[model samples]
Structure formats: C-alpha cells, structure tokens
Target: MVSDRMNSRAALWRVAAGQRGYFTAAQALRAGYSYQTQRYHARRGNWLAIDRALYRFREFSDLPAEGDEQLVRWSLWSKGSAVVSHATALAAHDLGTANPSRIHLTVPRGFRQKSDAVILHRAELAEPDVEDRAGYRVTTPLRALAEYAADGEDQDVLDGAVAEALEQGLVTRRKLLHAAQALGARAELGVERALGAML
Candidate 1:
C-alpha cells in the first residue's frame, strides 16, 4: 500500500510531467486523489496553487512559477476554441504594447469560460484568419488590428497598433484597406489611413 507521502509525491509528479500547470480539483480527484490532499501537499511545500484548482510544481521540482504568460496560457486551456483577439492579438503580433493586464480572448459566438481576466469576444473565425503566435494560436495580424481598432478605444492607440503592425511586416496596406472597406463607413478611418501610409 502506498503511504501518504508516496501518494503526495506521485500527485506532484503528475503535475510536473504534464504540459499544463493548472488542474481543476475534479481533475486531481479523478487522478486518484482528493483536493484537500493536494492542498495539504501545497501547504507542505510540495506544490504551489496558482488559482482556484490551478497548481504548479513545487520549487524543488525546478519548474518555473506560472507567470502572466502562463495565466494567459491557462486562460487558453480553459477556452479550447478561444482565439487571441483585440489588444492581446495585437501584442502577439508585436504590433502593440506588451503584457496587457486584461487578456483579450475571442471564441466562437456560443463559447464561454470562467475567467474574469479574459475580455471575451464572440465572433466568427475563419480557419485562414488565424495564426500561431509564440506557440499560442491567435487571429491573424490584420484581423487582430482591425478588431482592436473597432473596439472603440482611444483612436491614437489603434493608430499606433496599426502602425507597428505595418512596420513589423505583419500586415499589408492592401489587406488593411480591404478590411477597412469591409468594415464600411463606420470603421476607424485614421487607423486605416495609418496602415495605408506605411505601405
């Protein structure tokens, strides 16, 4: 029979071996353990709870602590169909500021999640309209910029994002113009013009 210490070690190992650092209480429980047990181990320095049922490896496991990027990643894990959008996607494209506090996530119209940090947008996504950003798949550069510009934030921020996007070669003038035209007369013309000026 396995001792409590051995079981705790095994559970910790499971968390260390997986690509995911976050695990729900139900997941830990289903893995032949209890949530309280996991908590006990964490209290004993065998693990570190991130948030909710989410956890990370103990310091001795040599695993890095889950940081903002990891939280964003966890948010993605929680949202299987979510695509990075708006400012989050713009940042991913290196077209805007970095490490936004409120991570923007877009999923299909009916998808939802439990995260409050995520600014969720329900929009239709075409397969070709997305791309892999630093291993996290997100909306394409042009689409991301367009979405942010349309979000009705300060127009200057949108212009800067579009400018950076063009400077980084993540988007083309023609693409931006076409997208603006599609968005019609109500679209932010300044941001579109910024795109045009760059190309």
Candidate 2:
C-alpha cells in the first residue's frame, strides 16, 4: 500500500511538472487517487485547492505565483484545446506596444465555452501555427501579429509588434508577409501598410 501511494505521487508529479504544478481532479483520479483519498490529501495539506476541480502540490510552489501558472491553468481548463493568442501572444513574445488587461485565448471554431477572464478567438488552426511552450501553447509571432490585424486591433500596436518581431528575429520578413496574405484581406492590408511605412 505504501509503494502504491508512492507510485501514485510520482505519476501525479510527472503530470503536474508539465503544468507548473497545477492539475485537475480528473487528473488526480487518473493518478490513482480515489475521491476519499483526494479529500484526505487536501485536508492533510498535501494538495492545495487553487480553483474548482483544480489543485497544486503543497511543496511545489510558493504563494503569489506568476503568469506562467495562469497560462497553465487556462490551458488545462480548456482541456488542452486552446492556445494563448492575440495580445497575450504578442506580449509573451515581447512584441507588442499595448498592455492588454485580459488574457486572450484561441479555441477551435467548434468551441463554445465562454469566460469573463479570457477573451477568446475561435478558428481552426493548422498544426504549424501553434508553438509549444512546454506547459502550454501559443500562436507564433507571425501568426499572432497577423491575427491581430485580422481582428482589427489598433494599427499602431500591430505595426510596432511586427517591427519588433522582425528586428528580434522572431519572424522572417518573407514568412510574415506570407502569413498575413493567407489570413484575409484585412490582415494582408494591415501588414502591407505596416511594412510599407518601413520602406
């Protein structure tokens, strides 16, 4: 029984490691924690309940966490179907001029969930459009800027972010243009306007 418990802890740790120490109740159940066992662990302070159906290990972190934990939480909350996007992705790549107050997430076109904490964009994404962040996913810099333009974000912010991304080698000029062209007329025009101003 002791060995079984240890093994469960090890498995749960592996799962939480990829999520900045956050895990869902479903994950705990899969890790061999029964409902009663979970309650016992929670009461004993071995696990800290951070949100509805969500938990973090007591020893894995200090109080007052950072943005990475928030990203992990929402990614898990979306059942891993969403990617950090728009202004949030721009900020993550250090490419934007605007300090957006809300976190942005991109879900599939079929996704129907709503949340006040996140501004969600719905579209089907090709595999190459997403970049893995170890604990979560985000749109690539080129894609992020293009999506911003497509959505009619402030042109100044788009121009600044695109220029910064290009200057920092986060995206190639050719690929940036190509992605914009593929997004739509609005996105392509916005990108063209930004690039034209540079010349």
Candidate 3:
C-alpha cells in the first residue's frame, strides 16, 4: 500500500525533475510539504538550500550544473519573466566571439531588478523575438543580432556575430536583412557590412 507521505515525495520529485532537481519553497508547499516539513528536509540533508527560498535535492549537489542550468536558475529567480538576450543570446546561438562577463536577460519594460551577475534589458518583446530553449527562454538569433546592432557594441564583435550566424545557417540572409532594416540605420549597416564577403 502507498502512504500519503510517499505520494507527496513522489509529487515533489516530478516537479524537481523538470527543474534540474531544483525547486522553490512555494513549490514544495504545492507538492504537499508544509513549511515545517520543508525545514526538516533541509536540515536533514534531503534538500540543499540554494538561496533564501530556493533549493535542490541533495543528490544534485555532487554534480556540476550545465550552462543552461544557469539560465533556468535565473528564469526561476525572475519567476519566469526573463528571456536570455544580447551577447548571451549570441553565445547561446553559437554565432559570435562575445564573452559576456555577466548574464544578459531581457525583462518586461516595467520589470526592475538589480544584480551584479546580470545585465537586464527592458523591452516589450514581440512573440517572435523569443524562443523557448531547453528549460528557459532566449531571444532568437535574429532578435539577438538586432539587439547587438542596436546596442552599438564594438563593430568588430557585431561583424563576427553576423558572419558566424550566416555561415552556420542559424538565420536566413533575407530574414536577417529584414530584421536589421526594421531596427533602423545602424543595425542595417552592421548586417550589410558583415554580409559583404558572403554577398
């Protein structure tokens, strides 16, 4: 026979599985773990405390987290309102030489946040601008390029991103050209110059 305790643990495991073995205290509550039980698990080493309200199964502590896991952690931190963008998105798409020192996240125009680990861009993103990644959201390569050009990043960096994205077939030339034109002058010029040899 199955006990309710077993059922609750199983339920929480299901949720944790989807989050790389991580979960929030509120999520534990929804999985039938009371605050007292949550405390007990943390103290007993069944759960590893990650932040003020975040945790992961202790079993996951022994292994290294994947790159995308950072995205998930930040997405969870933002309560799923952030989309990885800019140089980070460029790297995610594997089309640039950008080595972003901080994670770049795009949040709603009204969103306000502060963190040394992240650089937040505020915009009301259109649906097509974002793409659902493994367990998080990221700006599409097209959107990423437009953002990079608009940000006026070093021209050399922009050229590298555009060239790699085109050679790797990550974005169609016509689509990229269209995206750049829509973003206005400077962006269009960057894409144009990058496409020089390819054109």
Local distance difference test values of all predictions, in order: 0.65, 0.86, 0.84
TM-score-wise, the better of 1 and 3 is 3
TM-score of 2: 0.90
Indicate whether candidate 2 or candidate 3 has the larger TM-score: 2
Runs of candidate 3 with Cα error greater than 4 angstroms are 197-199
Model 3 clash pairs? Answer: none
Candidate 3 C-alpha lDDT tens digits along 1-199: 2587898989988987787888889989998899999999999988988776788888766778676777777877777899999889988887778778999999998887667899999888899899987667999999999888877787788888888887788888899889989888988887887777456
Task: Please give each candidate's TM-score.
Answer: 0.69, 0.90, 0.87
In order of listing, the candidates' clash counts read 0, 0, 0
The total of clashing pairs for model 1 equals 0
For model 2, the stretches where C-alpha displacement exceeds 4 angstroms are 63-66
Tens-place lDDT per residue, model 2, 1-199, is 9999999999999999888888988999999999888888888888988777788888767756665678888888888999998888888778868568888999988887777899998888888999999678999888998888888878999888888888888888788888988989999899988887677
User: On a 0 to 100 scale, what is the lDDT of residue 107 in model 1?
Assistant: 77
Q: After superposition, how far is residue 25 of candidate 1 from its true place, in Å?
A: 4.8
Q: Model 3 residue 97 lDDT?
A: 88
